[model samples]
Target: MTTGQIAIIVLILLGAGFMLISAIGIVRLPDVFSRMHAAGKASTVGISCLLLGAGFFFLDEFLFYRMIVLIALIFATAPISTTALARAVYNNEPALRRQLRHDEMAGSVAEAISAPPADGDDAILTTPS
Candidate 1:
């Protein structure tokens, strides 16, 4: 009914919508990369809108600044962190269990682990030294 009430409603709607859409994306997406995209987009926007709007509703300058800073922190870290996690999973996924063909790094660890023992000159000697 009031302007403040309207703003609060709008903020809630925006945050809820983003979260719901993200949930759908996570459930409906076909693979790891796409799911990560969906989660990152929804959560970042949802947190920014929700925290920023709560700051406005609270009418405190410190709260507002804190909310904005928190949003900035999320944006600064969430995507890159999530992307790296996804990349790690993609790169190190189990060979026999993974269905993906784009994993060039998938077998790197396995190859290293399975490689034959190096000869005397090539092997490291840690005795006493």
Candidate 2:
């Protein structure tokens, strides 16, 4: 086999390995946050590597552009999606919330939970006299 083919195979194997580890992490982790963390990081990199390998193997203009767009989309959205998922888990799952060592959004949560509703009739507006 050519060097390029070998490199492609290696990259694909490495990507598969990362994906396997990510799957294991999702299964083994104690909480949603940790599982998301593992899956988000590992899967993003894994998919990227796999795409890179495919792109290298194919080496066409259309394929290259598609791969670039896919990679960019993954890079842009993965972290945002992970954060959103974690926040949803945090909001919805009390049991998992307790497993967290530090509650970064605790104050915001408390404030939101404690804040009273603002009724139109209760609004106090003062104009500069």
Report the number of the highest-TM-score candidate. 2
Over 1-129, each residue of candidate 1 has an lDDT whose tens digit, in order, gives 899879987997898889899999999998777788898889788877788679878879899899888988888988789977775554344432256555454445444344433563312211111
Tens-place lDDT digits, model 2, residues 4-105:
899999999999999999999999997777788889999998998899999998999899789989999999988898877876666556666656677666
lDDT of each: 0.71, 0.78
| Candidate RMSDs in order | 8.8, 8.2
Error of 1 at 87 (Å): 1.5
Q: Write down the worst ten-residue block by lDDT for model 2.
A: 120-129
Best by lDDT: 2
